[model samples]
Target: WLAKITLVENQVLLKYFVISASLAGIIFLKGAEGRICKTFSAISRLSNY
Candidate 1:
């Protein structure tokens, strides 16, 4: 039935949204870590100088 099809489509869309959001979160976390590492390295170099 049309109603069943709509429900299935909605579920698929919801799953896709969840997966994309999780991926975005992981990317953001990695970016933050990279920034922190770069900052620490810079501080170390400055201290050495």
Candidate 2:
């Protein structure tokens, strides 16, 4: 039935959206972690000087 097909399409679209959002979140978290690490290293070096 047409209704069943529409439901399936909607489910697939929802899954894709969830996957993309999770990937974006992971990338953002990694970028934040890298920035924090770099900042810490710089602070330590400055302290030594």
Candidate 3:
């Protein structure tokens, strides 16, 4: 069961990594200079703390 749980956790981590990468790509393509990008960056910064 530990192995199974580890596998599930890995899958979840991979999914989130993919989502983050996609969002980053979109933000980069959008130039990250837009208001929305700034807002997102601010939110991420807050979440970091």
CA displacement after TM-score superposition, residue 44 of candidate 2 (Å): 8.2
TM-scores of the models, in the given order?
A: 0.60, 0.61, 0.53
lDDT, candidate 1, 2-49, per-residue tens = 666787799998999999999999999999999999999999999999
lDDT of 1 at 32: 97
Top-TM-score structure, candidate number: 2
**Which candidate would rank higher by TM-score, 1 or 2?**
2
In model 1, how large is the Cα lDDT of residue 45? Answer: 98
Candidate 3 residue-wise lDDT, 1-49, digit = tens: 6666787799999999999999999888788568778899999999999
Which portions of model 1 show Cα errors greater than 4 Å?
1-5, 38-49
| Residue range 16-44, candidate 2, lDDT tens digits | 99999999999999999999999999999
Q: With candidate 3 superimposed using the best TM-score fit, by how many Å does residue 18's alpha carbon deviate from the native?
A: 0.1
For candidate 2, list the clashing residue pairs, or say none: none
Error of 1 at 10 (Å): 0.6
What stretches of model 2 exceed 4 Å from their correct place? 1-5, 39-49
